[model samples]
Target: MNSVLINGITMTYDDTGGGSDSAGSVLLLVHGHPFDRTMWRPQQGAAPGHRVVTPDLRGYGGTQVVPGLTPLSTFAADLAGLLDHLGVRRAVLCGLSMGGQIVLEFHRLFPDRVAGLVLADTFAQGETEQGRKERNDRADRLLRDGMSGYAHEVLDSMVSPATVADRPEVAAHVLGMMLAAPPEGAAAALRGRAERPDYTATLPTVAVPTLVVVGSDDVFTPVADAVFLHDRIPGSRLAVIEGAGHLPNLERPAAFNDALAGLLATVRESARDGADMTES
Candidate 1:
């Protein structure tokens, strides 16, 4: 629940120590749209020996929300400012859903600052014209009818039907997070997302080690999307969490954490090798 003024907004973030004597590489976890940093609770202590930071993207959680259409660059700039404020020179960026898109934009803007990338349940393509219309229409609905009905409407797609039926607690938790989101902020993000650039061309240029994770049953951003990213990103690895949906990190934290641990190991080894080369 820490707050810092970054990019002219009071951004809310959680900073957990990297359990190492030296300043270790950071693991910055970004949340999806309509959800805040709390969505990353399961991953907080999971990355021991690495600084774990989870921030509520502007307009969500404890952070101040600006009115009108908020671009993804605004979110990316907030992250850059946050890292500068924290004195962190580089970090491994992990993001989910809309958060994933932000990570891509961040890399595009600050490639040298990224040690690695983990994109979960997200896509690199921009929205189609019809998709944009639907998103805007949904935004209009949120402005008019509010979040209660909209939360329930999108709850089924956010997680798997199995999660809803078998894991009542997880389903309820996701619903609660959505219902608690500020309608205006959520709508603004939806509108902003509609205008995101096509990042497909940017994937192949990613020189850092990358990991693409997706739930086996994620209808929203299907496994196909993950495969698309893995194929495009030269050396990227893909992990499919069986039986989970869009929010696999919440629905199946253990599997998600394992994949993340593997990515961290690769990034750490790469950093060590680079340092050794420099010293030699």
Candidate 2:
């Protein structure tokens, strides 16, 4: 429920302490549509030795939508600015869906400030034609039929049928989160995704360590997409969690935690090496 003034909007974010990290780095988690930053709680608890900051993002939760900004990259810039405000020069950025897009854009905008990146159930680049049209259509549908009508369609894509059947409340909460998003905000957010560039071509050049994680059943952004990204991103790891769909971090928390722990260990060790090289 805490707020950070970024680009004139009071963006909401929560910074929860997670164990200790003498390395002086923070882990920033960005949530996808319909949900605020709280979607990342499971991963935050799993990944210790770093401060975890989950932001509600602009137009979500208590954050306001600002006028004049492009809405999408404006989000990236806002995130970077928030880091600056927090006196964090570099940190790992973990994003899901829209959050992944934000992470991509933020890296594009502020490369130096990013220590690493985690793109979960997100495309390497930008949106495809069908995807763009579908999101736009959903936006229009939400506006026309209202949140209640569009909630299930928007929320159900994240989890598999087995999950919905076993944990009905999980599905319900996710759907509720989608239903609760401000219409104008959701519309604008969709527009931002539509206009983003594909980052696939730029993956190899990414300076920071990257992790592309997906669920075995993520039809939204399949395992193939993660593999493609992994192949292109030099050393970036590709992790797939079973028994989940798009939201692996939420659906299969333990597996997500294990994958995350592996990545963090690798990154921290590499960072130590770089630190040593600098010291010498």
Q: Rate the local accuracy (lDDT) of all candidates.
A: 0.91, 0.79
Model 1 RMSD in angstroms:
1.3
Q: Count the backbone clashes (under 3 Å) in each candidate.
A: 0, 3
Strongest candidate by lDDT: 1
Q: After superposition, how far is residue 135 of candidate 2 from its true place, in Å?
A: 2.8
Question: lDDT by residue for model 1 over 1-280, one digit each (tens)?
Answer: 7999987889999999655422236999999978999999999989878988899988888899886788899899999999998888889999999999999999999999999999999999988999999999988988898889988988999999888888889989888888888888889999999999999999999988899999999988999999999999988999999989999999999999999999989888888888899999
RMSD for all candidates, in order, please: 1.3, 2.0
What is the clash tally of candidate 2?
Answer: 3
Name the runs in model 2 displaced over 4 angstroms: 18-24, 67-71
lDDT tens digits, residues 96-213, model 2? Answer: 8888888888888788777888889988666789988987887676667767777766466778877788877767767777778887777778777777788877777787778889
Query: For model 2, what is the C-alpha lDDT against the true structure?
Result: 0.79
TM-score of 2: 0.93
Instruction: Give per-residue lDDT, candidate 1, residue 56.
Output: 92
